[model samples]
Target: MNPTAAILIIGDEILSGRTRDSNMHFLAQELARVGIDLCEARIVPDRMQAIVRAVRELSAAHDHLFTSGGIGPTHDDITADAVAEALGRPLSVREDARAILQAHYDRSGIPLNEARLRMARIPEGAELIENPVSAAPGFSVGNVHVMAGVPRIFEAMVASLLPRLTGGTPLLSQSLRILRGEGEIAGPLAALAADYPDLSFGSYPFQQDGAYGAHVVIRGADGARVGEAMTRLAALFPEDRAG
Candidate 1:
């Protein structure tokens, strides 16, 4: 079975509509590419209780839990503390993490001030995730991986963390565009879905130039099975097929 995962987005800005979260989208795609099933996602404010509650719930439910945002140097960046509380782990500035941040700031000709040292505060027994883009590293305690909110830094941290994880067969997907409405195809698609219980099907409708159509997408762990299902789907709708 594929390893299951969840994403926890912790930030007040994201909840306030000031920041559009792109990490979930990126992490979902990347996790799927490596065969980790992203089963759930959530966005919570920077509140300690809210973040702590989500962290416990998601981490308990999934094999892996990735958190994005609220790990910056600002006072509102409370992900570390919340996660530490959630897991009953102590939060402190580790020498190793501090050394990394110190070296980074030193190279950039910036002083490692008190505010900047907050980046080094890690949850006990957590492993540091490398951030090539920025000096502050993300951390993994148990199944929960705490990452930065910035898109660039988050992506970098994911790249560094993903390879260390064990993955299953990559999920394969195939889509067939049909010039028919979802109502026109729902019955057959339902029947088809029943025929291949191992595969998952989706019908996304779209209107282009006043013509209604749907993109029938099939996804599965087995590439051959996915391809076969796509072929069957196309044959079932050959009359209204577009691509």
Candidate 2:
């Protein structure tokens, strides 16, 4: 079985509609590519209690937990502190992380003010995840990896982090679009799904130009099995084509 992972998105902007979150979508795809099943995701405001509660629960529930946002320079960036509290670790500025931040700021002629120094407060005994986009650096505490919320920075951190974890076989999928509603094909789809217990069958409905249809997707870790299931599914619905 593939290792399962969860995401905790922390920021008031996401909850307040000031920001549209793309990190979760981006991380989901990246995790899938590495064969880690992204089983759950949660978004919470920039509150200490909320961040701490989610960090503890999600880290315990899945093989891996990734948090985005709340690790920046501002006062509201409390993820590092929350995660440390949740894990019962001391939260403080480490020299390594401070050096990274200081170097980046020095190069750009930016002063290392107290606000900027907040980014260096990492939890105890955590491994740092590289941030190529910015030098603040995300950290991995046990199973949980805390990263930046900005899409580009988050993606860079993911690229740096994925190499550290092992994954199972990537799921393969084939799709077919049928000119029929889900209700019309429910019975056949159910039967097909039953025929391939190891594979996953999904029917997503869509209406285009006033015509209703559904796209059926078959997925499995075994490519040959997924292909066989797709062939049978298409044969079951002879008029179907690729969507």
Candidate 3:
């Protein structure tokens, strides 16, 4: 089986539609690049109980769990606290995180207030994920990785941790856009998918300028098989190209 991952997004802002949750899609794409199959995603509010429950559940369900949001200096940022609660431990300021954050504050010449210091609090026995843009660190507890809520910081944290994660063979994808409707090629695509059961095939329909187009995407770990599938797909629709 492929190595699977799940993402948990914790924030009242996202739940209330105040902010669009972009972190899940970013993690999904990055995990795909690293050969980790992103199988599930959940977005919960900033409530402590909900955050704790989602973290615990996702951690147990997937090989890797990624969480974004609620780890900032604001009052609503309670991800660190919730993570500790989930693990049945008290949240404490981690020494390494504190040191890094202190240096950041010192360089900026801004006094590190208690609210900012809250960023140093991490779950017990967790490895820190470095944030290159901001020294506020993310952390890993067991299979769950806790990260920042801001899209920029969360993406940087993910990039930092990518090298440390061992992944399976990376997935390869091939796509062609056929000047036809999805209904016209759905049967053929399904048959091709069945022929190469190891691969996944998807057909997406789009309408533009009174014309119909279907984009067929074939993806799998085996490069040769993916190429072969693309060949068969092209044979099914000779006019299809990389539109």
Candidate 4:
């Protein structure tokens, strides 16, 4: 079976709409590529209790839990502590992590102050995740992987991490754009989906330049099944075929 995953987005900025979350979508796509299903995503404030609660819940429910945000040097960066609390692990500054940060700052001719040192603290028994974009590293304790909220850093961390994980068959998808209202094709789409029970089908509606249409997507682990579903869907709406 494919490993199931959940995403925990921790930041008051995301909750307040001050910052839009791009990590969830990015992680979802990356996980899907490696055959891990992203079953749920939750946004929690920077509060420690809220972070701890979400960490506990998601960690228990999914095979893997990825968390973004709140691991910086700022005061609101309480993700490490909260994760420690949730997992019942002690938090401390590991010398190896501190050494990495120290060398990074020293090479850049910057002072590694107390605030900067905060980044070295990690949960007990966790493995450090390398950060190529930044010196400060993320850690993985149990099934939970803590990562930076910045889009670039998060993407880099995911790239480094996914290859080490055991993934099932990669999911394959095919899409066909139909220049017709979703309602017009709803019945046939449903019947097609029923006929291909092994595949998953979705219809996304769009209105462009005063024209309304839907983009139908077929997805499955089996490429032949997805292709067959796409062909059937195309046959059902030949007049509205896009390209």
The digit string of per-residue lDDT tens for model 3 on 1-243 reads 668999999878887888888988888889888899998999998899998899889888899999998888989999889888887877898788899999999999999899999999987889999999999999988888999888999999999988998898889998899988888888888888989989989888898899888888899999999999898889878865545
Which digits, one per residue and each the tens of the lDDT, describe model 1 over residues 90-145? 99999999999999999999999999999999999999999999879999999999
Q: In candidate 1, how many Å is residue 149 off?
A: 0.5
How does candidate 2 score on lDDT? Answer: 0.92
Instruction: Give the clash count for each candidate.
Output: 0, 0, 1, 0
**Which rank order by lDDT, best down to worst?**
1, 4, 2, 3
lDDT of 3 at 39: 86
Clashing pairs in 4: none
For residues 1-243, what per-residue lDDT tens digits would candidate 2 score against the true structure? Answer: 999999999989998999999999999999889899999999999999999999999999999999999888888889999999999999999999999999999999999999999999998999999998889999999999999998899999999999999998787888889988789889989988998999999999999999888989888999999988888888887865645
**Ten residues in sequence with the least summed lDDT for candidate 2:** 234-243
Model 4, position 160: C-alpha lDDT score: 83
lDDT by residue (92-182, candidate 4, tens digit) is 9999999999999999999999999999999999999999998799999999999999999989999888888888888899999999999
Off by over 4 Å in 1: none
**Root-mean-square deviation of Cα positions for candidate 4 versus the true structure, in angstroms:** 1.0
Greater TM-score among 1 and 3 belongs to 1
TM-score of each: 0.98, 0.98, 0.95, 0.97
lDDT of each: 0.94, 0.92, 0.89, 0.93
